[model samples]
Target: MDVTQSTAGDVIEVRPMTIHIGAELFGVDLAGSLTDEQVAAIRRALLRWKVVFFRDQALDHEAHVRLARHFGAPTPAHIVFGTNESHPEVYSIAKHRTAQNGRTSATRCWSGWHTDITAAINPPWASILRGVTVPPYGGDTQWTNLALAFARLSTPMQRFVEGLRAVHRFDAPAGDGDYARRVGARDLAAEHPLVTMHPETGEKVLYVSPGFVKEIVGLEPSESRALLENLWEHAVSTEFTVRFRWAPGSVAFWDNRATAHLAPVDIFATDFERQFYRVTLNGEVPVGVDGRPSTLLSGEPIEAQPA
Candidate 1:
């Protein structure tokens, strides 16, 4: 359904892309300061829709950080990927730059479905990704509502997952001995619930991230793999997902707590250039259905100062 709300005499258009997961929000400018009412409305839409897209936004590094501050504290760019030099909070997802630098290795961490930085004790609460340059075709990003995915599971399946936990790790790139050693020293691994409760909306989220999640805690490796495979297959079903074709000046803001997103694989097959900038918001430690919080297995949390 299309929702248009008039707040402070400004019409903010919220056009739902699907019954669940994604929406296109119009009428708000991210390059400038936002009013309290506008921020609140946007946050409400984010919680309800899981992810929101904005078209034709003009946001530089400073403006991107400033806009993200309205919702939550902006964390550093990434633990592994690092951030933009001048703007410490802005992480560039520059494909051309990485390709030029020969950083693309056998490890395909960023190419799979994941919630940002699950290896940390406190994963990001939300993420805002703005497209700087986009390809003409076949570089669409996709998101799935984990809450909805969990809701559709059988009652017995829900009960089993609620009591289970899994370890998430940032796999280091292959063939880089020194870099791999550094990553191994940091040991970016954390155990989080297979099912976690959303801190804001209080909805149950299927917290298995196929990219970072390694194995289920307290289970045999085979059993863990099998269970995780089933969960991953179910979580990414087409009905629970929404795909967004990106363009320059497009921005996607999503709640990291209740969603997992797939980065474009088709982009690598083409010679087209694609680049984007992302800023993540600080998130609390995930709490399971039994009211227990996730435990840090190795790495420190990616903490962010107050916005």
Candidate 2:
């Protein structure tokens, strides 16, 4: 697709990647402090596009966290992973060198599409990820706009889901070794509406995804499984999705409340390495259309302090 750039009063140049869901912003240095107007412009683009990309940004761990604070408080790097001791809010997403050396043959283990930390009572409001060691080819991530996904469903289907709630839990892949063990220790879980009103934009989001949502509340096991399967399929349909190819120095900022993202499955097929660092903004409890908040099933809310 041809990227179309437009300037809005010298705030920033927005190069929309598609008719919906994704855009690339130009003329901002993520490494430096942002003026109030710059911050507001970035936030407005994020809410409208669901995800925005920046190319050739020179962002270190501290700069990454600093940029996040302009929009909201930064959450702990991750619930189960170790972060840099000095920069506790910067989470690394790199493959271990030891694991790389040991693997002569590879098996695909997809993380599946998910919003950031939905198992928490307050899932992250936004996430900023910067590419570090990008592969020469492949390892492209994709995101689906849940608000648009919900809007495209039949009227009756939308109404039926609006009243529903689902259970979300951080399910670590079994036999994944250390990472799995830590996630097992945490065992975070929550019950959230299948559809929630975006806290800032007031749009309804179809909140279920294969990564975290476990089952629909108050349904028979078989019935819940079948229903969830159907919803997951529709929520990630191509019409509501946008794919991004990553390069070193590229960064993506996304609204976690209104989107679910797929990690690069093709990376497993290549010997080339991929790595990234991310900081997530603390989120408010999601409210359903009926005006109810999500219920915590297990674990405490993620701890975060302003950056």
Taking the tens digit of each residue's C-alpha lDDT, what string does model 2 give over 1-307? 2223344444687877777799888889989989987888888889989999999999998888889988889988887665654788988887552222221111122236778889899998999999999999898999999999999999999999999999988765657676566777888999999999998899999998567787799999999978887888898888889999999999999999999998775777778888888889989899999999999999999878644
Residue-level error in angstroms, candidate 1, position 212: 0.9
Error of 2 at 162 (Å): 0.5
Tens digits of per-residue lDDT for model 1 on 1-307?
3634444544577889998879999889989889987888889889989999999999998999999998889888776656556888888887754422322232233337888889898999999999998999988999999999999999999999999999888666556565564565567888999999998899999998777888899999889878888898899999999999999999999999999998887788889999888999988999999999999988788889544
For model 2, the stretches where C-alpha displacement exceeds 4 angstroms are: 1-10, 96-111, 172-176
Q: Each candidate's TM vs. the true structure?
A: 0.92, 0.91
Candidate 2 lDDT for residue 158: 97
Task: Give every collision pair in model 2.
Answer: none
Q: Name the weakest run of 10 consecutive residues (lDDT summed) in model 1.
A: 99-108
